[model samples]
Target: MKLRRRLGIEWTGVALAASLIVCGLIYWNSLSGFDNLLYDRLSEYDRPEAPDDVLIVAIDEDSLATFGQWPWSRSRHAALLNQLADAEPKAIAFDILLSEPGDSEEDMAMANAAAQTDNLLFPLHFVFPGTNGAAFDIKEPIASLKQAAAAIGHVNLLFDRDGVVRRTSLCFKDTANGTSNDEIVWPHLMEQVYRQINGESSAIFRRLGDCQQPLLMPYANRGDFAQVSYAAVANGEIPRAFLKDKTILVGATAQGLGDQHPVPLGDGGTMAGVEIMANLLNDITADRFVMPVSTTMQIALSLIPTWILLIGFWRWRPRTTIFVSVGLVIFILSASAILLSLQIWFAPGAALVGLALVYPVWGWRRLQATSDFMDGELKNYRTETPDIPVLQVPLGPVDLVTEQAEELAHAIKHVRDLRRFITDALTNLPDPMFITDLDGKVKFVNKLAQSGVEDGVQDLALDDMLERFVAPEGLEDVKDYLAIDQELREHDYVDFTSVKDEIFAMRRARILSDEGELRGHIHYLADITEVANAAQEREEVLQLLSHDMRSPQAAILALLDGQDATDENKRIESHARRTLALADNFVGLARIKSSEFSGEEILLSDLVIEANDSLWPLAKQRGIKSTVEDYTEGAFIIGEPSSLYRSFANLIDNAIKYSPDDSDIEIVLRSIDLDKQAFVSVTITDQGNGIAEDMLDQLFERFASNDDDSHGTVKGTGLGLNFVSAVMARHGGSIRAENVREGGARFTVLLPLAPEPEELV
Candidate 1:
């Protein structure tokens, strides 16, 4: 069944089962005397009127008060019977047994009195059930009294577990010295009296059918039955009108006899055994009984409310269903009370109890189901992940289905909230992420994880930990697999190339449980393409700078070979300074666009002078004339001063190297206007074979030079101009390399003029 509807009937079934178990337990306990509560409750119903045909000549407390205690001679009981017979009663039934020839003459007197009175019935004391666990009657009536009676009937009363007399056996098995036929199947004293007076079989016993033959008996009234004192009857004080034609019972109602028992109709004190028999016989004769309602019928009636409750849960609100169930139970109970009032028996506690438990059991079941559903959803998202889990509780027991779903709902809500938080944290992360099982199978992959992977990639496999993708031929695996400086191999990480040549840093971590056992892997893949490229470019630039710096070292060695020691020493000093200047330039170029962005005003002439001073020794070694037309013009910009000096020095040194021996190299500074903004311009002209008209555009590019064909004597390192261009761009300036019409090359530098002192303010 779908959970929603299963929810309705599931708990209802639980209620029915639990209630049945409880009812059955109670029924068993009642068999052990607890059921007296139910029977005692039934006693609250109205009772039948006493059968006027039967009367008790009670041997009461008042009789005991008058007749001097109990155990009065059997001759005294015979006197009562004979006196009762004189009134022409239909039958005189004695509740007392004339057993054991006590005072033989007195016993003979009682027996002789019974023989003379034709309608007197003597008590046959049979064993089974009369006294608990005894097999046979202890003391039956003596031979004389037994022969004198019209019929011998067993007064074997049946008491319920609570010690209350609710019924009497219709027949008795007289396992004693009694004759066969009717004596062998001895009848109840009440039944014998009933047969003698009514002349018909009891209909109440027949009503039980084939059920376990326990008859339900009801009393006619509470307390005293129609009676006269036994002493009164025996002394002839009771009038004949009170006993005439009546079925008089001569039995002990005296307190000293201890023959009293709780009956269905008595108020509190025990009813005398004789009175109990009187009530039974009277009840039988009047055809009044409390027959047990058939189990089939009771079950059917119970289902009425059960179905109502189930239907309400299925179609209506739980509260309404619960109210209906309770109402139906009350109706059944009220109807049972009415039936019992009319002296009938009915019990529907099972159904009432079942419905009572339905609400909570159902609610608890739904709570568990909801928790399981939420857990399942969390483990693997059902329909796309929910923003907030909508977990709610079903109906409950006392809180009824609808009335008290709040508590369970809150419980589910709490768990769902936790699940949502975890899901959001894992799935919505900016970095591409994945979760894999212990077997190395991909269980989950976040959006970024999938998007960052190459087109053919879907999952990560354990076997490919060290070799995720094929390496290109001839690239050192050691350099590519491991970082440049590190020797340790990181097999749990992989760097794969995307179709767009993009690089992703895929790192995997082992997820472990609390006990430190490996659970799975949490892989995070991030796009590191730009970062990787920048690192490669920086490495290449450093290699180039290291190689080019050897040129100044070669020149310093060449100076030591000069003939004059002074000139050689002077040139060596200049070459050493030049080498230092070149090192500073490489450092400045590398540091230009870095985080240090402090700027200040520097004169244009100062930069030119510094560049010329550093390059003058090189010009002298090359037999070249290099001159700087220094101008004190405030030609500067708001930029790093060291980077600016490096840029100007690059242009001057290039001019000096490219010019032939004794060739003129002039450095001129001027001011220009573009877009109404003042800019400082420095021009360096080299008078040599520098007319490379086809390579002017590529001149400032890294590794581009006039020696493209390798035919020129000036071997350019090709990085200095690129460095110069980059440094100029960092200062918001421009560079130009052109063939001067006077048969040489001219390189121009243009920088924006720094604002005046007032403008700074």
Candidate 2:
């Protein structure tokens, strides 16, 4: 589904880009304004060097001042041409048209002077909307001037749509379907001069397929061409040697004469008509005209980069695409400039338009697509998860992305609410708790957890936090337990007293992500101070009872033994022994339940021997033959000595009570392997009635006994087995009882072997 959505967005962008490229190619002329403007600006960097041979004889304000303007007589033009002809110039072109008859004497003088010159060219201009509805009416030099020594050519200028003269036609064909004599083709006046000088057409004219084809002319700098004042040349004030071997174009340059037109000089100024011809003649002579690219090439150049950027959108990020877009703009312009320097013109407007247009359009479309996808996903989430109601406001109408933004905002609000609820629950927890990351840096602490922390606890190291609150005596033990891998630690909780004398049971659990990856830990510090204090008081009371009550029981037994061997005395002695055993069991059970496990290295064989010896007197009275087989060969385990001694002693005493007279009670100690870890197992078996089948599951439970059908006169106190079970648990060990199949019940106890002192170090 995501793949399809992504493809859809890509296709939309491609289609938009293709449309822009097509429009650029189809309506290229409509967009040429920018290209022309750019061309005008770029042309300034490499303007053509004006040739020394082409010179303009300007009828400037000075000339008009001297020669008396306001339709200066034709005799003045005739005199100027005669002077130019005397200079031995290559050619002379008269820019002032003389189609209509002028004053008789001046006209005759101009005609006679033109007849004398060998290389004179006459101007022939056209007037639009001919009298007979022909395309245009040609105005030529008068009949006598035309029949003189040289050819006639048109002096019309070609302009672009924006009224700037940038191109010229070398020749114009007569296509009005007139008579053969009228169907003549005329070259530009500058072209005629070039032909007269070289005896051949200019290079641009020779290459034209048709006389009407326009040539893009590179202009010389304004006023750069050599010029002489008309009055100065006409009166021989300027030296003829300066005009020697030059093509002279004579025309008006004065502002009052109104002979100037706008050119692509980029200064928004005008050039005189004679100066325009001078530049054109220079372009023709040097063959330096700029040819525009073919239509197909222009379209290709414009579309290629636009499409490259369009494709780039799919691969690059928004930032990269933006840079690429700007780069494409620079590339297109640079290419245009380079080509222009090589005398080739390429229009960059359409290409630039495509690049500039497609970028933001595609960005908007992509953002809209992404917003839509997010909206759908968020809606799906709202439907699947438990509904969290949010108030809705009417927005009336909006864009899709804006609406999606609102939806996203609402979703974020709901998430914040849920987080706040969780935070409040944790803050109000009865017990203190803190959260830490995998690096053991505390990330969160509840109110209760902040009790002893002087400053903010966030991001504090776990060990540092523990050191701040945990009492000095238990800090090392807590740290050791926490240092062990959570999965490898045998115990679930560690007990520690805070600096404030409050006891706490700290349990750590993993905080996992939804995929069950461990992200951190949550340490819950349960306040067990009151429970611990009560347990301490109970143990003290039990200890006092054991010592105080055992003294009286022993005195009673001792008195009875000295006085008589009567039934009453024997019964009193039996009861007193049972009472003493009961008190010992109560005290041992209380101590095991309340106290923390602090172990030291002890030999398992020695403990077993000591337990057996402690109960030897009772076993001897019952005539039970107690035997110990030491197969373990001195295995050491870490355990509390007092608890372990009472546990083993109680096991042997139970065996003695259950066994018949003269039966053998065997205690075997052996080292064994359980789950790849070293352990010591103690098996005690008695030759007596086996345990009842119904009592096996609850054998280790408190107050559990098999005394319903007694095997001996002295019955068992149910708590003796319970206390032994508690002690075994504290030592990271286990005990189980089962029928031995031989006839009596067997008790197997397994305790993990402690590492050697050297190994621990």
The prediction achieving the highest TM-score against the true structure is 2
Q: What ranges in model 2 sit over 4 Å off?
A: 1-34, 37-84, 87-277, 280-358, 361-369, 372-406, 423-529, 546-551, 554-565, 671-679, 706-717, 753-761
lDDT: which candidate is best?
2
Evaluated against the true structure, the overall lDDT of model 2 is 0.84
For residues 179-208, what per-residue lDDT tens digits would candidate 2 score against the true structure? 866766889888898899999898778886
| Shift of residue 244 alpha carbon in model 1, Å | 1.1
Task: Please provide TM-scores, in order, for all candidate models, with all chains considered together.
Answer: 0.48, 0.55
lDDT of 1 at 467: 36
Note the Cα lDDT for every prediction shown.
Answer: 0.68, 0.84
